[model samples]
Every structure is written in structure tokens, then in C-alpha cells.
Target: MEQRKIPFVIRPRALGNAILVLVIGVLGLVMAHHPMLFSGFRRIQTDLRDTRLIHYLLEHGYLWVCGIPEHRTFWNPPIFYPVSNTAAYSDLLLSVGPVYWLWRAGGASPDLALAGWMISMSAVNYAAALVLFRKGLGFTWLPSASAGFLVAFGAPRVNQISHQQLLPCFYVLMTVFALARLFGGNPQRFWERGGLWLLAVLGGVLQFYSGFYLAWFLMLGIGFAVAAAILLPPCRTVFLEVVQRDLWVILTAGLVGVLLLLPLLNHYLPVARYLARRQYLPMYYAFNPHLWSWFHVGGNHWLWGWTAGREPFRTLGYPPEHLLGFGFITPLAGAAGLYFCRERPICRLAAAVTLSMWLATTFLPGKAIALVASGVAYYCLACLFREFNGPRERAFGLASVLALLVLVSFPNIYLQILTLSALMLCSLELVRTRGRPECQVVPGIALGLFCLKVFSLDVLLIGVCLVAPAAALIAYYWVGRRRDVGLGAVLLVVFFTAVTTILDSPNVYLGALAASSSALLVSAPRRLRPPAWLSVRALIVAMVLVVWFYDQDSLWLSFYNKIPGGIGIRAVGRIVLILLIPAALGLAALVQSLEQKQWTLAAWIVVLVCMLEQGVTTESFDAAANRATIAGVARQVTPGREAFYYRPWPNPGWNTYHLDAMWASLVTGVPTINGYSGYNPPGWDGFFAVDAQSTLDPRDVLAQWERAHGLPPERIQSIGLDRTCEGPQQTRHRP
Candidate 1:
């Protein structure tokens, strides 16, 4: 008798696990966000302004373009009436719109559809992450489920509930899973490879349509992954082989991706040209994450809520964007993973020394010079001991010794010869090593110290010390092989420790040099086992550390700000959403290991702690009340007008009314000049000026529109204000 095997069958245990995950996840979500879930979709989560904009976009704006036949074009949304391509001013929600529309078509109100869309997206994100971890990454059920929960409902993401555009992050996990499968192993069949490539491209396209921030982040993540694959010896061959075999497929996919992205680029490029890139002051002070942010849990958390609106957490304004805490259990587990792996002892030591030195330098004064001199001395000695394979090596050693002697002889020549010589030597080392991870660490550290001295920013050595070890640890743990630490790596540890003493940022160039130096310490090849100790677990810890130290208003961030699109990124802090993957995986691995070791109580305790840490309450506003307000304002619009502008009182109290006017336009199928969104239309300031006057003259309002947008006065007129609806603001439900 021949036995036939069935594919895609769910085992009883696996099915039970899946059901359990869903049960717990849904119960947790309902408990945490009860207001949002139980409001019958008559309430919205987060800020009223953004929630309304998102609702309008999903229900009316994008739907109209897709054949609903609204009065406005796809590009020109009703709000910000006269402005062209106003939809491009923010995320268009292209991927999420279809699902919302489905719900709406199935008899759901606009609010209900939006609410359902958010909850469903969260569930989908969880499912995608579960599959990625369980099937793609080959983790067991417990770890996969735990990680999925963190990825979908982590504290950081809960805090960002107002940002409806950021909700559709399932595409990111799907893209990662596809890329991993596509590159991690060889697929004999062409169709299989092609399918993976297509999936990857679609995931990326969907991610871009979902939100630009995540799209940019996905690109960065891919670049990092590719770079790691190339640098790590074991993965390099497979990566190269895949590239060679699938060159045509890769190129075709890229071309298709570009074609798909053209519409988005077309809309965004013009806006990018018109608006000035975000400046340093705004990015650094307002949008950049802080070191404390990663530990700053939201006030909605049951356990950590007490810390909210307090020191450290409340130091930075814009609590929603800044609440990036991944909770205590995740990081502790990550550290435990590193400790259990115990593969890169030297790398871990380097991290510890660097961190200690940074703390020492931060609190202590006048230790920087001594520490720096010691670092230079150690580098010279390491150069002396290093084997001279050729004349270039010998010459470099001689130059290093001479440079140290010169520094010792003339200490006051701070900004001249020594700084230049150190930089030149660092460049020479990079060239000599050809970017071999083991050989580049010492020179990089030396160069960073010299540059810090040159800038007279000895106190800022704290920044260099803090970032250097993190980069080194990440490079070594993720890419380096056993026994790969050489004279350079050894010298780097001492150099980092000594330089740390001087630690304490115009040293943007110094920070970048230091980061590059430390980051270049990739050595040897990663082990080739399925669950290699130093593979995923170590990588997660390293990445979390990188985000912790560099995501803030630090030198690394300053360097990032100089990149072409970097300035345009309003919320670099949002990178936490991506970090949720590694954080969740780390927690899962820890729990899985604990359970395997028969430490059942510990595993349960860890899981409970994570659940509590990730728990959060959401704010919901009365959409029904706002809809009534919109209806009241809609009746005020005159018939047969191309557009009507509403002028609410120029005060914070009347802000909601201004938003209502935009909503009224949607209801009446007429364009309204009143608008609210990410980017203001050109000459919007003039419109505000006109509104501030005591009179409500149509000509004056039309003239202001004409002066700002150059829209023809005959095409638009002003509508009378609805003073009858002037009452207290709508009630909000908070849980």
C-alpha cells in the first residue's frame, strides 16, 4: 500500500497553540484598549485631528479616486481645497484602504470600519510575525507566539495608536520572512525563487503605500542585512550564489518595484522640492529619540504607569512619539541570550569596558587627556607588536610610533599635525585592512580620540565611548568567527577603555568616524548551524543596543541627519516599530529556553512580566458627536459653488470646528478651503490672517486664496460660520 502525504495540515497541538495565542492576544487587546474596542466604532483612538484625517482618507479620499466619484480628484483632497496633490502631503493609506472599504461595504459605518481596520491590522501583524518566527525562523510555538504578541502590541506601538498610518506593519514582517527564505537557502526550482522575489517586491510596495517611514526603514534594514551577509564569511558564499543565480530575477523585480513606486515618488518629489528639509533644531530636539526613551513606558501601562509624566520620561515633549520603552524583561532576556551564547567574550568585554568608561567620563572631570594619551601609547605598542607582512605594514608601524612621539613632545599642537596624522593613519589602515573586521578597530578608535582632542571636546568622549563598543559588539557577535580577535582587536579593547576615561558632541564628524571605525570591526564568519548561539539572539541584542545608544540626539543621529532623505524623516524615533521584531524574538527565545530547562515558573513569570509591560490604555473620541458637528456645518454650505472656505475663530478652542469644516466638505460633496494635515498648503498663513479679521467678507477670503495659491476668485466663495454649534468640545473616553 502506498501512503500519501498531505501538505499544509495543521497538527492538533499547533492548532491549539495558535488558538491560545489568539485568545490571549484578543483578551489582552480588549482589556488594554476597551474604550476603542467597545465604542461601537462611534469613537476613535488617539488625537481627534489625525483620526478624522485618517477616517476621511480611508472612507472618502482614496475611495473617491478608486471610482466612488467624489467632487475632488485623487490628488486634491477636499480639505486644503485649492492645493494640488494634497494627498501626497501625508501617507495615502493605499494598502489599508481596501480593507477599510470592504468593512464599509459590508454595512459598517465609517467610524466602525476604521476601528475594525485598526484591530484587524493588529491581528494580521501578529499572525504574520507568528508565521515568520515559527515557520520562517524555525522557532517553537511558545517563542513564536510570544514574539508575535510583542511585535503587534508592544508598548511602543500602543503609545503610537494615534498614528493610524503606522498600523499596517504586517507587510514589513512579511517582507522580512520572504527575504530570509529567498536568501537563507537554495531553491532548486526557478518558480519557487521567482515566487519569493515577487512576494518580497509586493511586501515592499505595500509597505511604502502604508507609510513612508517604514518603507525607508525597510530599505535600511535590507541594506544592513546584505552588508552583514557579505561581511560574514559563512553567509557570503550563499548570498553571492543567490545573487548570481537570480541576477535577472532580482533586476526584474527591482524594475517592477520602481514602476510601482513611481506614482508615490511623483507625488512626494514635488512636495519635497517645495518644502525645506527638516532642520537640525527640529529633528534633534523634537523628533529624535533619547536614551531614556527606551525605558520610558507609557502612563497607560498598569505597572509602569506611575513613571509616566514624571522625570526622565516626561523630559522630552511629544510623549506619543517618544514612548519607546521595550520593557525590562526583553532587554534582560537579550543580555541573558548573549551570556548563554558566550561565543564572543572579547566583544562582550569591549562593550562592558566602553560602557563603564563612558559612565566614568560622564561623572568625572579632567580624566580625558590622560585616557587619550594612554590610548595613543597602547596603539603605538600594538603597532610595534603587530607582524609586518610587507613594507606597507612596517611603514605604517613606523609612522604610528613617530606620531606618538610627536604628540608627547608637543602636547599643545592639538589641532594641527597630530589630528591630521591620526586621520591619515586611520584612512591608511582602512585601505591596508581592506575593511577586514579584525584589523580596523584599533585605527578607528585612535582616529576618533584624536578628532575629539582636535575639536577640544574631551568631555564628548563619552559619546564616542558609548557608541564604539555597541558597534563593535554588533559587528563581532553577528559576523565574527571564533578565535578571530587579532592584535588590532585586542588593542581596540584597551584603546576603548583608555579613551573612555576622557569621555564626555560639533564633533559630528568625530562621532561618525568613531561609529564607522567601530562598525567596521566585522571579523571571521558566523557559524553555520541552524540555531547558532551567536546568530539571531546576539544580533537582536546588538541591534537593540544600537537603537538604544544611537537613536537619540547623539553623534550617530547627527551623522544620519546629513544623509539625503534623513532630514525629511520627521520621526526617527519611530524606528522602534521595526526594533519590535528583535525585541520580541529575544523574549521568545528566553522563555522557550527556560521552559526547555524545566524552569516552568520562570518562563511563566517572564511572560507575565512582558504582558504587563506591554499593556496600555488607549484614548477614544466620540466620532458620532463629531459626525453630528460635521452634518451641522455641511448644511451651511451654499449650493452650486466650486468651493467654500470656513472661518472659525482663530483660537485653540475653535480648532475642532476648523476640522469640522473639512469634514463638512466631504459630506456635502463640495471642496472646502479649511484643512488640517501634515503639510500646510502654500500661503496658508495668509488665509489665517484673513480669518483673524473682525469681518467675514467672501471677497477678502477669496483674495487671500488668490494671493497664496493663485486660485481664481470666481471659483471659490466664503461660507458663513456656524455659531449655533458653539458649545463645549465633544467628550472623550479614556481607559
Candidate 2:
């Protein structure tokens, strides 16, 4: 491949430009939140306010470092008394601990400290994106900068503001860069000896500290990459070479992160299991992706109203704010990026590997395989003995075998299997039938199966919309290359017929519209007679849309929508806006292709619009008065006094007192029973038992009180029960 010069004027190599990008990101975030930053009002992003758990974490870490005897271990804090190991509740030890200690020591308020730390992390995230794109990919400054901006302030970061785990994403980027060199055979700088292993280890460490969920996500990604290397001969050779050079570094770094997590795991496992038993499976399916949700413009933008209520999308984890995947242009940009990188075998392979890992992580393909295997085993057992006189036993057996094959096939592998199988069968038929027109029948059947496979999982959900564009791509390609049309045309016709049949059944009239639009693009190059690449580019974009459409797994297999009342279709629009990040990347590639100065500026302008309209950091936090009141109340409260909130905790959707308890605890240096955290302490139920009868019946309350105090029933009546756990207003909000 010939080396291409930087397409833009901006010198991406200059240290000053990188610094300027970072500065701009920081200043932009601060300016966006000027209402909270400039004023003395404390800033707490949306997620923090919803849980106030991080506030507790920051305060807990500070006192631990300060050597305050009572605050030494958050486990035995005055709040949530009897429930222990509060420190095990979150991924706070490394990410937020040090930052909180520094800011607290400097006399910043708890809310202010938290806000500052979050802002600072956002800046780091922005800078890291720039480094990954510019340094790792070797893109010119404009495209690299565009990628950086999208990543730093993109949907994932904005949606995960409360998570703290997702904020420190730079380490993950560094790790990816390392892997690119090791497996993708992407070149590294001369001074970068041992950099791959070092980055892998560092990314692991920081990822674990940043958030266990993201750490697991990263590990899964690494596992997939390793698996890919092992499967592909060329990639395997590269992997083996890297492994031989620094096997110990990889092992040691991985072990250190795991060893550090052992203590937290020991405490966290029981609670996780407990919650999993009740909520895991049901919640998992509930959060499945609704097909239409992907195209809806997110609520973050002013233009959201245009597509807001049109689709019913949903999620179980974060709201639409955090669930952003590639937005409306997912079909367009994803295809364009792939087409641009089509010549780079390694880049395509890496993308496929990463995407496969994400699918596996979200869908638990292993479990699906196991379930299918069990079903097949049962069928085989039945077939061996003829136990039941079922209708069409041969047909059942064939279907079962086919289902098993599909179940085990990974995402990209499935695409190859379908495409190759069609080609082989079609070619064999053509030879057997002596080049007769009937040879088309075999490929037609296979193409129909492919279409069926694409939509059978979720009738209209998951990449169903891609059918139109995909058909167009196939048709256009067939038209352009008449020599290959014999079998290809048969496949295209069969595929189109199958897709339109399904769409018509569901009354989805948009299929025809999509096909028409794609056809128009395919014809544009002929009519306008523009650049030679324009028509091909348009076809590629259409092809990408078609490929991506069938490539997606149905919502039934996804983890995001598992929980009951997860972000449902009504609220899923915003999450789809995240697609814009990749779309921006695609625009960069197009600009690079055009090599035009004006188009480059236009790309930057689009990024700026994304920042202004889609930005969420500004709206993440509540006003300063709330923080001030909580602080005031905390100061007046007696130090070392235990406190607990009412029966139920605050909800982001409804409740207003979410941050009150934690904020007061931080200010007063008192521990309280009413605390919100990811992990529910083992003894929480024992300490605050509330069955149906206890909340309403005085006698039941007394009985419960006596059990809690380990006292006789007569003594419970003598003690006033009303004072126990106090009213919500007095307990959570009082000074």
C-alpha cells in the first residue's frame, strides 16, 4: 500500500495541537456547566444524584486515608449499621479514591470534589481518544481529532457519567493500540519495546479500578482477540511471537489485577448471586433491542422531537442517555468505514473480532450453544428409539441439525458460512445441470434461507431495516458486473423476494422506499459523472447497510434489556444517538477520500454541532442549593451518629431526596444506615426487616422491633416505634 500524506493542514503530530485539543475539551465541558462551575453551587451529575453512592465512596476513601479511626473501614460505618463491607459496594478504590483525597484535603466540599473529579476524568477521556486515533491509527489530525472528540464526549461516556467505571477509558484505548501492534501487525515506534505487554497490564489495572463491569468487558474483548489469533494462521504467528517475547509480563500483570480484586470478589459474590437468582434471566430478555429504536434521534438533541415518539425502544441498565450505540447513520457510516478499510485485512479482522466479543459478552452465546446442544441431544435420543410417533420425524431431525449449526456459528462466521455455502452449492448445480437455467434454483433456495435466518429471530427487530439497502447493494453489484450475474442474480432475486415477503406480512411499507433510495444512489455516478470513486463509494455505503442489517443479533439474545422496566421503546431513542460517533468517523473517511479543505472544515463543524446538541454533562447535575442544604444539615448532625433513610430509596425518575443521605454523611462525618450502593450488604435484611404485616400493623412492628433488639415482646411496646428509622423528610433531609 502506498503511504498517503496527511489530508488536512492541521499538524496532528505537534504536541501543541494535542494539548490544544485536550484544553478545548476541558474548557468546553467547564463552559457547558458554567452555571454550576462558576457559581459556588455544587455540581452532581444525573447518575450521582440518582444514587449518591459515589459521594459516599469519595467521603469513605478520604477518611480512610486521613487515618480517622471511626472512618478507617467503610464496612463498619455508622450508616447501614449491622450491614458490613460497604467498601465492597463499588469500583471506587483506585478511580475515585485518590482524586477525592486530594480534593478533600484542599478543603473542597464533597459535591464540588466529585464534580471536579468527574470533569477532570472527562478531559482525560477526550485526550486519550485523540492519542488512540492519531498515534495508533496514523490518521491525519482532522479525522483523528474528530474520532477523539466523538469518543471523549460520546454516548458511552455521557450515559455512564454515574458509573465512574466507564470514565477512565484511555487505558482501554492504550491497550487496544498495543493489541493492534501485537496481533494486527500495525507498526510501533522504534522506542516502543515492551510497550504492548506494559499497556496490556496497565489497561487491565486501570480498567479493574475504573469499573469491574468495563474491566470484564475489556477482558472479554482480549479473550476474543486471542481466540481470533489462534484461529487465523497469519494472526496466530504474530500472536505467538508476541507471547514468546513477553509472556511473563502478560501473566504477571493479569494476576496482579485479579489478586487485587480477590477481596472485593469475596464480599461481592454472595450479593451478586442473590440478585442474579431473582432478576437476571427475566431482566435480560426484557431489555432486548427494539428494531425501530436504533433510528430514532435521541432526546439529547433539540431535533429529537422529530423522531422521539415514533419508536418504542428500551434498555435495562442505563437509560437512553447511556445506551447510545452508533445512531441513525449506523447503517450508513458503519458500511462506509468498513468499505474504506476493506483493503486492510487486519483492520477488518480486528473489527470483526471486537464486534464478536461484544456480541458474546452481551448475549452469552455459550449458554445459547449449550441450550441448543441439549435440545439436539433430546431429539437424537428420541430418534434412536422412535419413542414418540410424531409427525414428520425426518423433517424434525433436519431442522434440529440446522438449528444446532446456526446456534454455534459466531456472527461474522455465520455470514461467511451463508455466502460460501450459497456459492459452492450454486456452482455445483450449474456443473451438474450442464449450465441450464434450472441451476439457479439451488442458489435461490440458499438465498431464501439466508433471508429467513436474518429476520426469523425477531420479525422486524434487529437489522430488519437493512433488507432494503442490502437487496439494493446486491442488485447494483450484479448490474455492474454482468460476468458474475449468472449465480449472483439468482441469489439476489431470491433474497429480495424473501425480504419483501416478510416486510409485507408485517405491513412494513418502508422496504420499498429504502430500496428506491439505495437505487438512486447507485445511479448517481452515471448521471452526475462526478469523481470515479463517488459511485463506488455510494454502492459501498449501501452494501454496508445491507451487511450490517443481517449481521446484528436479535434483542432476544441481548443483555441490555434483561431487567424488568429497563429503558423501554419509549425511552430508547436517546441511546441510539451514540451512533453519531462512528458516523463522524465515517464522514472523516469520506473527507479523506475527497481530500478537500472545505469538506474537512464541514466535518469539524458537524462535530461541533454534535457537541452542542448531544452533550449531556451540563444537564447531568442538579442545582447547588440541594448540595448546600445537605451540607448544612450534615454539619449540624452529631458526629458518629448512625442514620438510615426510610423504607425505600430515592428514584431518579420520581424521588427528589436521592443525594440527601450520602451528602449529609460526608459533611457531618457520621455514618448512616440509609445508603445506596451497587452491593446490598448481607445483613441489611436482618437489620431492617419489613414484611407485609410489619409496615401496617403496630403489633407486627413491635414484634419485629423486639427481634431486632433481641428483647422481650413487652419491652418493644414500652419503646416508641415511631422514632425508629425516622420519617423520610426528617431522616434524609433534616439539618
Among all candidates shown, the one with the greatest lDDT: 1
| Deviation of model 1 at 579, angstroms | 0.7
Writing each residue's lDDT as its tens digit, candidate 1 over 1-735 gives 899887887889978987878776786567546777676566678667777777777866445745755534667777776677888878888787888878877888777788888888888888899888787767777777777888888878878778888777889998888876776545779999988898898899989887787887777656655655665555677779889999999999888989998988888888877665424465445665666776777787767888877887877666777787867766676556435533332223322432332222121222344334333322332232233333344344434444444454332222233344345546556557754766666665665555544444553455456556765776677565423333344445434543454244224335434433333322212221222222223333322232223212253344455555555567767777876766665677677779889998998788777776787777788877777877877777766677777654333443465678777887777788877777676666555554455465434555666667766666665554334335423211111
Candidate topping TM-score: 1
Question: What would the TM-score be for candidate 2 when compared with the true structure?
Answer: 0.61
lDDT of 1 at 344: 35
The TM-scores of all predictions, comma-separated, are 0.72, 0.61
Off by over 4 Å in 2: 1-43, 74-78, 184-195, 228-237, 244-249, 273-276, 280-282, 286-288, 292-297, 313-331, 353-613, 617-623, 628-659, 683-735
Q: Evaluate model 1: give its TM-score.
A: 0.72
Give lDDT: candidate 2, residue 542: 28
lDDT of 2 by residue, 580-656 (tens): 33344454454454345466575555545545543443355564666665764455455434333323222222123
